[model samples]
Target chain A: MFSPLIDELINALRILPGVGPKSAQRMALHLLERDKPGAAKLASSLQQAIEHVGRCKLCRTLTEQDICATCTNPQRDSRLLCVVETPADVLAIEQAGNYSGRYFVLLGHLSPIDGIGPEDIGIDVLLERLQNEHIEELILATNPTIEGEATAHYLAEQAKRLEVRVSRIAHGVPLGGELEYIDGGTLAHAFNSRQGL
Target chain B: MFSPLIDELINALRILPGVGPKSAQRMALHLLERDKPGAAKLASSLQQAIEHVGRCKLCRTLTEQDICATCTNPQRDSRLLCVVETPADVLAIEQAGNYSGRYFVLLGHLSPIDGIGPEDIGIDVLLERLQNEHIEELILATNPTIEGEATAHYLAEQAKRLEVRVSRIAHGVPLGGELEYIDGGTLAHAFNSRQGL
Candidate 1:
């Protein structure tokens, strides 16, 4: 409402997820009013990231180099590859500190209704990696959503043909989750997957 | 977590209001994965805004020029001044499609406990405008918070000396609000401010 520059900035800020017009305007004003230096730093950083960051050729995870840190790290278990829908999932798995395997980021899941299929998400690239690499086990760590399940099952079928062992991450009530609050689908999954404890 | 450029971008993005580590990472990854061109555009827009947008010389609101459009517009009621806490408040008032008056942005309210006082919020500049301009009415549109009340009271006293009429925006139940769900203070205000219906 103030000026064209501010309007442009506000519109540009809407690219960030979950930011509505009001929030974008607030952000624009906040940057102009209180944090100009920080805004300038953010701008330069965004430019640098946009110019340098790209998908790692091997795993499709975001990186500035040819291969990502996880893919290049010799210490990680190269024989056990975890496949996830997005880089955020990779970060979550890393934060859990349980998995030491490398990752293959699908960047998105297969959604036929949305016209997103195997080839759309670089499944052929993942299959090529499976055939060439020494990976013994492929862990499907995609989300529990419908699209994620379909993608995982399709990848498992593809991996089977290449003689690679495939496994899906367990789906159940989360840790510290109350049984009463858990949804029906999750409760059912937890019940069906119950093992000797 | 992925690369130096990505890490830097994520850290820089945390400066935005409500953005945390996880949100920053998600934004970084989403930009790298989906909208590189949009990211670049946002960067340039941010840089341009940072370089151009500054506080209006008259009202302290954000603007690309020395004076904001509202302050410069001749059709708006210059004799009626609306004093608000921030530029966001100005935008909110404008979006409501009411109040055809000029604005004076205080940037913040008088929070004595936080070591913020009248001078810190440009009270002197407001007094100068009151004295120099032919303003007939001063609308105190600050927030309903304690600090905002104190600021409004202080400005009212200052405006009284200059013989400018002062009025505060009513604090009452919001439009379409149910009394059952309204807070005690708001309900009390609503009851006290009840007008002829």
Candidate 2:
């Protein structure tokens, strides 16, 4: 076993996604032995972000200020709001640079078995925005997983009740994907959802 | 793009091994969204370990004190020293639980192309130990790479000059390894080094 503090560092690093005990150990040793300056900077940055960054009051994406940059930007189309499941999803959409709209981060999707509901994912906050804002469309951009589909369906019902246009992001074989190599389920879904020319 | 602080955190986290842009974003979001307390603890633990931990004087392994625990342990065999390339190697040997000898970490191996030689890896410090201490046997436990082999050969010559016995870690097929699956180089070594038993 390593010294207590080194062991603690390794254990703490294990909490990161995809990091097991061996990777954590390697990370700790690499930091301590090879990259002390980088490690120090990482620690300070983590502390600062954790201490200051909170949910944007409007979109619920993480930010140091009340509203996130994307939500507050005048260039983005406020009337065409895209709702996503996490801040990372917001980033993904932003990086694509195709969407010129604001966002509403659910922070999670409905998972009844795990006891997470609409309330748990801040649906009430989203509803309040829908009630007040002149949003022309409510885009459902959640994942293609079962829970994500359920979430999109639930949100579509809500958007219909409010008479707002609602659409799910396209799901099929990925761009550049070979049809022959595509999974059966995805291929079937693509065939079923074949678009009119 | 994320807020300044969150973006900084993601960028800082990318310095870790195997963490690319996507993984960094995922980690930053995961910590902020699902595990704020865990993130805080990790930050504090990182800061504390970096601030407190330093290389042990005797063996050059990471420790808060001057001498590492293994070098100070009374139960370990001081007369039989195992030399390794890094602190991780020390842990690997310790986990095997069969070696009772103390360790001396080289932190690196000889690489003339990289301008790293005996002095750079603290071979001079190792020489001091070999000269001052009554170590009867020195075991070369460095990695089996070319640089590691060069380092082991260099250390072997030094130990021989000091009238100390030296041996390299065994090479060839691993325990429980199927002969058919073993590589040609390892199979050849195993055949050449076959014992009387």
Tens digits of per-residue lDDT for model 1, B68-164: 9999899999999999999989988998997899999999999989999888999999999899889999999999998899999999999998999
Alpha-carbon deviation at B49 in model 1, angstroms: 1.2
How large is the C-alpha RMSD of every model relative to the true structure? 2.2, 1.5
Error of 1 at A63 (Å): 0.7
What pairs collide in candidate 1? none
Candidate 2 residue lDDT tens string, B122-179: 9999989999999999999999888999899999999999988999999989999999
lDDT of each: 0.91, 0.91
lDDT of 2: 0.91
DockQ for the candidates, in order: 0.77, 0.85
Query: How many backbone clashes does every candidate have?
Result: 0, 0
Q: Which stretches of candidate 2 lie over 4 Å from their true place?
A: none
Q: Each prediction's TM-score against the native?
A: 0.92, 0.96
Candidate 2 on A132-175: residue-level lDDT in tens?
Answer: 88999999999999999999999999878888899999999999
**Reference-based lDDT, residue A67, model 2:** 84
